[model samples]
Target chain A: MPSPADKTARPTGFRVALRDARGHLDPHWWLVAPILILVVCLYLLPLGNVLLLSVSDPKPGLDNYERIATASGPLKVLLTTLRLCAITTVISIVLGFCVAFAMAHVRETHQRILVVAVLVPLWISVLIRAFSWLVLLRDQGPVNDWLMQSGAIDQPLALVRNELGVVIGMVHYLIPYAVLPIFAVMRGIDQRLLFASRSLGAGAVTTFLKVYLPLTLPGVFAATVIVFVFGLGFYVTPAILGGGRVVMLAESVSVAILQTVRWGFGAAQSVVLLVLTLVLIGIMAKTVGLKKGFG
Target chain B: MTDESAGQDIRLYGLSKYYGDFRALDDVNLHVAAGEFLTLLGPSGSGKSTLLMALAGFVEPTHGDIFVGGSSITALAPEKRDFGVVFQGYALFPHMTVAGNVGYPLKVRGLGKPEIAAKVRDALDLVQLGHLATRLPKQLSGGQQQRVALARALVFSPKMLLLDEPMGALDKKLRHDLQLELRQLHRRLGRTFVNVTHDQEEAMAMSDRIAIMRAGKIEQLGAPRALYDAPETRFVADFLGKSNFIEGKVTGIDAGIATLDTADGPVVHALGTRPAGIGDSLLLALRPQKLMLGPGPNSRKATVETAIFLGTHAEVSLRCASGLALALNLGIENAQALPAEGTTVELGWDPAATVAVRPD
Candidate 1:
C-alpha cells in the first residue's frame, strides 16, 4: 500500500532496469533505510563502543576474556547464568506445552479466558511479579506458614534469595513467550490427525509420542530459543528474587560498570552474552530446519 | 490383498445418537456382509458421518450395540476396534514422509524396523507412489495425497475400512479418477467398506448398496437401480436423481398398474414394492428421461414453456392444459426436436415409466 507519490518516485527508466540490484536499488530499500540508520546510530554504534572498550580499556589483548576461564568468581557467575537460564527454559516449555494444549482444544470462550490469564502476568511489571513471588515464597511467608500449620513441615523452607528462586522468577516471566509460539503451532494442527493416528491402531500414548509430539516440536524449538535468549538478559527479576545472592550475567555486568566502575569488564561480559546467544540460536536454527514445520 | 485378515461383517443394532434435542443418528439397524461396500448417502446433518463415526468407535451411540462377526464392539475404543478411517481432509501426518505415514500403523503394532520398511514400500507401490516415498504429504498433489491416505488405511489390513467423503476435496476430474481408483482398491482388498458422502453420483457409482438418510433417519436402503426406479418416499425419489412428481389420486387398478386421476389427465403408475390401495392418495414419481413428446396410454396436452439444450439431450419444461407443470428430457434420437417455447406439445409415458411414491 505505498502512496502514488512513492510509486512515481521509482526509477522506471531503461537505464535503471539494465543495471542490477547492486546499483538500481528497489523501492523497498527506502522503507528499510530509516530503520537501518536508526538501529546503527542508536544500537550498533553503542555495541561497537562496548566491543572496542572490552578489548582496549583494560590493558588490551585477551586479558579480560582470559579471566573468564582463569578466574573462579567470574567463571562461577557464567556457569550459574547458563544453569539458571537452561532450567528456566526447560520448566517454561514443559508448562507452556500443557497450557497451549489446553488452549488449543478448549472452546473459544474458555480458550480466550485462559489466554488472558496467561497474558495478564506478562503485562504486569516484572518487578511486581518478582516481588509477589518473593513475598509468597520467603521462609516466613504464607506458603511455609500454611505447610507448617498443616503439619507437613516443622521448619520453614528457604525458597527465595537462591538459584531456585531465580529460576522460578525467570520461568514465570518467560512462560508467555513459550506458550504463544507453541499455541500457534498447535492451532495449525488438524485434530483429525489424532483421530487418524488412533484409527491407525496407535494408542493414546503412542499417538502422542509419534504424531502429536513431532508436529509440535517446531513450536517447542521456537519457544526454547525465544525464552532462553530473553532469559539471558534478565536483570530485575533475578535481582529482586535472587536478593543479591545469585549473580546472573546481566547483574554481574551492571555491578562491573556501575558499582565497581569496571567498564571494560562489563563490556566484556555483554560481548560474551551476545556471542553465546547468537551461537545458540545458530545451532538451534540448524536443528529447527525452517522448511519442515508449519508447511 | 493379504489373507491374514479378511473383511468381517459389521452389524449395527438400534444405533442412535442424540445431541441434546437434535437426533444425529436415529435407530439405525444395518447388517453389512463380509466384503460388501456400502455407502451412507445424505446431506449435511442427515447423520451419515455420525453413523460412520459410530461404526469406527469415534462416536458412542446413545443406545445400541455394534457387532463385528457376531461380537459386540460398542464399548471398544477407536484404536482397539482395529478399523482404518480415511478422513475427509486425508489427515496425512505432515511431519512424516509418505512412507512414514503408511508405515505408522505397522510401527504402532510393534513391528520390527526391516519388516515395517518392506511393508511401507509395498504400500507406497500399491498407490503408485514408490518414487515419492521420502517426500512429505504437502509436497504431493491432492490426488497423490488421497492415494497416500488410502494406502495408509489399507496397510494395516484392518477388518473394515471407513471413508468419510474420500473425494470431497478433489476437483471434478480428480474426483472422477480417484473414484475409479477407490473402487478398484476396494475390489482388490475385499474389505467391508462403509463410505459416507452427500454426492449422489459418487454413491451410485461406487456403492453396491446405498442407505439414503434424511433428518437422522434412513429414508430408503437398496441398490442404486432399485432406489432410482422404485423409491419408497418422495425424498428418496428426489435425492437419488432428478424426478418430476404429479399429484394424483388412485381411481382404478389393472394387473400391476394403478390408474391415478390427476388434474392433467388419468395417469397410469406401475406399483412397486409398496403397493398403493385403490382409494389411497399418493404422488407419481416420473423420471425425466422416461417422458417423451408423443401420445401414449397416459398422455397430457401441454404448452412448451422452456427448452434447454444439454448436449446429448434437451430438457423441456411443459405447462399442461390443466396448469400442471412438468419436465422431460428429449434424447438426440428425437429428430422432431424441441418445440418452440409457448407452443403446444403432447407429453406421454407408459405405466411402468413412473412409480407411485408416498409423499414425505
Candidate 2:
C-alpha cells in the first residue's frame, strides 16, 4: 500500500520518461517549434490538402493521379521541367564554382566588389531581374548590338523569348545561391592543406583534383540541390523570359488551375513537383549523409 | 619506404623572410648533417618556427636558396621536396582514421591497394599504434594524437623530417616521455630532423646541437653543453635557462681568466674562450646549481628572501647588499637543514662556474 504523498506524486517511470523527453526536445523544440509549426500550417498543410483534394474531389478516387500518369501534357511538362532544371543546375554550378574560386583567391577589395555583384541582384525583385535579362538579351539589345557592331554576326542571333532566354535568366538568379555555398566551403578549407598536398609531390592540377575538389564536393552537392530545387518551382523567370512559348511545369500547373479550372489536376502536378524535390534530397542525404552534404 | 641510410644532407643559404616591412627572418644560414637532430630554440617572436617552415618549403623565403644533397631546391614545393612535416597542432585530419591519416602520402602517391594497406600497417606498427589504427584522431588523447601525427609523418621515409613544436601541446610528463621516444626513433631512423621548439629543456634534451634565436636572428648555435658553458651574449644566457646575472667590471686578466669587480663584491672568474680588457664591463651568467649555499672562503653574505621546494631540489632566493637577487639550488640533504627565511646565508661559486658574456 502506497502512502498519500507517494500516491499523489508522479510515478517514477513516468517522471523519468518526461525528463528524457524534455532532454531531447528542450533545445530544438522550443526554438524551432514556432518555425516548424508555421511550416506545417502554411506549407505542409496546404500541400497535404492539395494531395487530398487531388484524389477526393467530386468522389474519393484516383482520377487526378491517373491524369498525371496518363496525360501527355502533364508528362511532357514534367519531362521539360526536369531537363531544364538539369541543364540549369549544371551551368549554374560550373559558373558559380569558377566565380567562387576567383572570389576566394582575389584581393580583399576585389572580393568585396565581386560579392556585391553576385548578392546585390538577389535582393532585387526576381521579376525585375528576369525583365532586366530580357532587356539585355533581346535580339536588338545591347549584347547583339555589340556583336553586330563588332561584325561578329550579320544579324542578331536568337537570344531571347525562348528556352535560351529562360535558362540565361534562371542561371543568373541561381548563380548567387550556388556561389555562396561553394565559396563558404572554399573559404573554410585549410589553405595549408593545399600547400601540404602540393609540397608532398602533387602538381597544381593534381592537388586541386585530390585535395580541393574532394574537400569542396559537399558544397557542390548543396549548390546543385539548391539550384535544381529552386529551378523546379520557378515561374516568374520562365514566364517573362520564355515568352509564353516554352512550357515548364509551373506554367502548365498555372494554366490547369487558373485557365482550365482543373484544380485537382494542378494540385496533382504540384504534389508531383514536391515529391520529386524530396526524392532528390533524400538521395543526396543518403549518399553523402546529412552532416557532410549540409556542411 | 626507402632505407634510412638514403637520407640527404640539408643546407640553407642566406634564407630570409619578410612580411612587407617586417622582417620575420634575416639572412639565415644553416646546415643539418645527414642524420643529426638539430633544434631551433627561441622565445615566441624569435623566428624559429619561420626558419623551420622555410626549410620545409611551406614558408617561401623572400630571398635565399635551400639545397638538399648539394642541389638547389629553392623552387621545390613542400610536397615535392619530400620532407616529412609534423605540424605544431599535430594536424591529424579529423575525418581520417589513424591508419587513414598515416597512409595519406602513400595513397596520394597512387600506391596499389595492397601495398597501401601493408605500408599503413607497418607505419602504425612503427609508432606502436597498430591496435588503434581504426580509431579516429578525435577519439585519441592528445599524446596519442601526437603519436599518430608522428606515425603519419614517418609513414613514408622522406628526404628529411621537420617538426614544429611537435610535443608543445602535451603535458610535462607526456612531453618528457615523447621526447625520449622521439630521440630513440631518431636514432633508429638515422634521418636528419629539424625541430623547432621554444622549450629550452626540450631542445637541450633532444637536439644534437641547438641554435638559440633572438629577435629574428640566431644568437648562438652550438652543442647543448657547449652553449650552456659558453654563451656568447646576455640574451642567449637568459633565454636558454635561469641565470643570476652579476654585472661587473674587468679589473685584471691573467692566464686567460678575467678578474672582475662585481657589485656583489670582487669576484675572480675564468673567461672560457674570449678575452676581455681591464675596466671593460663584463656580465657573468651564474647558473643556480653552480652557487654553493653555505659559508665558504669566496662567499658573499646574502639574506634569504624566499625558498621553494622543487621535487628534486630546493631553490633558495637570496638578496645581497648589491640588490642582486640570486637563486641557488640545494639538494635534498642540504635542503633538509636549510637556513630559515630572513636568516643571513653565504653563497659562492667556483671561478669556472660563471660564464662571461657580452651584454646585448
Candidate 3:
C-alpha cells in the first residue's frame, strides 16, 4: 500500500534514530543503570512509601506532617536536631582541617602512623566507642576519680547523659570522615604556588591565607556537607552517649515506631530528615560543584 | 669593546654549588657589565641554569658570593633581591587573566588599583599583548603566553632580568622572529639581561657576550664575534658553530700568526693572545663558512666525498688525505659549476682564517 521510501522510513528510520540516541549516551551508563535500579528499589521506593504512609496511613490526609509544624514538642525536636547537626559539623571541620594539614606535609613514616591512628577509630565499632566514652565521662567514673584525686573539684562533675557528651562522641567519629576529603584536595595542590606567592613578595601567613586557603575551600565545603548529613541520621552514638536523656530526631523516630506504635508519625519524621539532608546536599552541590562537593 | 655607560657590574666570586657529593657548579667566577646581555650557553647538565638560579636567589651557592652593583646578595631572598625572573615554562598563572598575571607583582608590592591597572596596560602594550589582556593563560597561544611571561618579568623594571631558556618552548620560525625582536627590545631597554640557553644560534643572535660553559666551568667567555673568531679551546669552537679541526704540530711563527704542519698542508693560524713554541702539538679550528670552494688563489686541492645543494649555498665534504675531511660552503653563484661526487676540487681560505685552539 505504501511506496518503498515511505516503507523504509517507517521502521528502519526509527530504528536508526533510536540506535544513534543510544550511541550518544555515555558508555558507562550501563554500569550506572544497575546501581540506579538498586537505589530506586532499596532506598527511593522505601522513602516514597514512608512519604505515602505519613499522609495516608490510618486515613488519606496530610495530618501527620501538619502535626509536625503545629505540635510544640515535635517542632522543638526538629529544631534541636538541626542545631546539633550544625554544631557538630562546624566542630568536626575545624579539627579535621588541622589534622589534614598535618597529614599533608608530614614525613612519610609519621604520615603512615597518623593514618593508622585515624583509621583505627573507624574500624572500632561505633557502639564500642560510645560505651568507652560513657565509661570515661560518667559521674564517679575515671574522670571524677581523677578530678577528686587532683582536688580541683569538691564533687563529681556532670559529663555524660547530656547533649555535651552526645556532641563529643559525634565529633570524634565524624572528624576522620571529614579529614580524608579535605586532605585529598590539599595534597593535590601544587607546592610551587606557595613559592610563587612568596617570590612575588607575599609573607608566609599572607600566602597561606590568600593562595592556599581559597584553593582548599571546595574541600572544606565538601567535608562540611558530608559530616552534617551523616550526623543528621546518627542514632547509636547519641543514644549510648546521651544515656537516653538528650533526644535527637533519629532517637525520637525510633521511639515513635517502637514505643508509640505510630508508624505514620515515624515515617513522617524520617521523610523530614531525608528531605533536610537532600536540601543541604543540593545547595552544596550548586555552590562548590558536584564532584568536589562529594569528594 | 668596553663602554663606560655599562656599569651594572655583576660579580660572582668563587661561587660553587654542591648537591651532596655531586658538584653542580664548581668555583665559578664571572663579571657582567651594566646594560649588557650576557648569555650562559651550555648543554643540559652544564650548570648554566644553576648559575642563573644562584643569581636570582632561587639557589644558594655553597662557597661564594654574588654581587650586583658591588653589593652581596647571597643572604637576600628572591623578592628582596629585586631581580625579575622569567622561568623556562613561562609559569604564567593558569587561573589569572593576562593583565592579572602581569599585575600580580605590583599587587603584591601593595600598589594602588589605578596604578596597577595603568602599569599592567603599559607592560602588555610593550609586548604587543594589550588586546589579549582579559584572556586567561590557557585561552592564548603558546607564543602569546610566552610574551605575557616576558611582560610580567619586565613589568617592575627591575635592576636585572634573569631568563632561563625563555624561548626554549617556541617553534623554530617563531623562535627566530622572537630572537630578533628580543635583541631589539634589549637594546632599547638597556637593562642587564642574563639569559641561560643551550641553543647556540640563539646565544649567537641574542647575547652581547656569551659565556660558554661545560662541566660546571666556564670554557670560554667573550663577544659573539670574538668567541667565534678566536675560540680558545676545542669545546668552545665546536659548541659555538661547526668547525673542521686539523691536528698538527706548530712548525713556525711569524709575528703573532703561527703556522702548523698538517695532513692537508701547512695551515697558518692567527694567534692573537695564545703563545706556543715550535714543535708543540696544536689543533686548529677552521670554520666551514670561511672555506671558499673551487679553484682560485689560496685554494688547496681536495677530492669531494659528498655535495649537498642547499637553497642559498651548497655544502661540499672533501677529503684531504686518508683520514682528514673538510667541509666547505660554496655560494649559489658558484653552484652552476659545482664539483660532482668523487671529483677533485680546490678549496680555498685566507691565510689567517683559522685559529689555534687547545685540544679538549
Candidate 1 residues lying further than 4 Å off, grouped into runs, are A1-40, A58-63, A281-295, B1-5, B272-274, B301-306, B319-325, B335-344
Q: What's the true lDDT of residue B48 in model 2? A: 93
In candidate 2, stretches whose alpha carbon ends up further than 4 angstroms from where it belongs are A1-48, A280-295, B1-4, B92-104, B107-117, B132-141, B253-257, B338-344
Report residue A232 deviation for candidate 2 (angstroms).
1.8
Question: CAPRI band of model 1?
Answer: medium
Name the TM-score of chain A in model 2: 0.85
- Per-residue lDDT of A1-295 in model 3, one digit per residue for the tens? 6455554443432343423332454444565689999999999898889889898876888878988888998888888788888999999999999998999999999989888887799999999999999999998799999999999998888888888889999999999988988888898777755655656666777778777887788899989989999999999988998888778899889999999978898889888998989998998888887787655
What is the lDDT, from 0 to 100, of the residue A226 in candidate 1?
A: 82
Q: Considering summed lDDT, which 10 consecutive residues are worst modelled in model 2 chain B? A: B1-10
Q: List the candidate numbers ranked by lDDT, top first.
A: 1, 3, 2
- Per TM-score, the best of the predicted structures is 1
DockQ of every predicted complex: 0.76, 0.34, 0.29
After superposition, which runs of candidate 3 have C-alpha atoms over 4 Å from their true positions?
Answer: A1-44, A67-74, A103-161, A246-261, A279-288, A292-295, B1-8, B243-272, B284-354
Summarize candidate 2's per-residue lDDT along B1-360 as a digit string, tens digits. 446556788887888899998889988888888889999999998899898888877788999899988899888767678888888778766566888778888888888889989988988888888999999888999998888888877777787888989988999999999999999999988888989999999999999999998877888999999998788888888888788899889889899777888777788888877778899998889888888976664588999998888778899999999888998888887778777899998778888888888888
How would you encode candidate 3's per-residue C-alpha lDDT over B1-360 as one tens digit per residue? 344224266999999999998788999999999889999999999999999888877789999999988789998987787677778878776667899889988988899999999999999998999999999988998789889988888887777778889899989999998889889988988889999999999999999999999988899999999999899999999899989888878899899777878777777777676788899998888888888875554467889999999989888898886468888877888866778999887777776777888898
lDDT of 2 by residue, A20-107 (tens): 3224433324666899899999988898899997888646888888877788977777887888899999999999999999999999
Per DockQ, the best of the predicted structures is: 1
Worst 10 residues of 1 chain B by lDDT: B1-10
Clashing pairs in 3: B8-B34
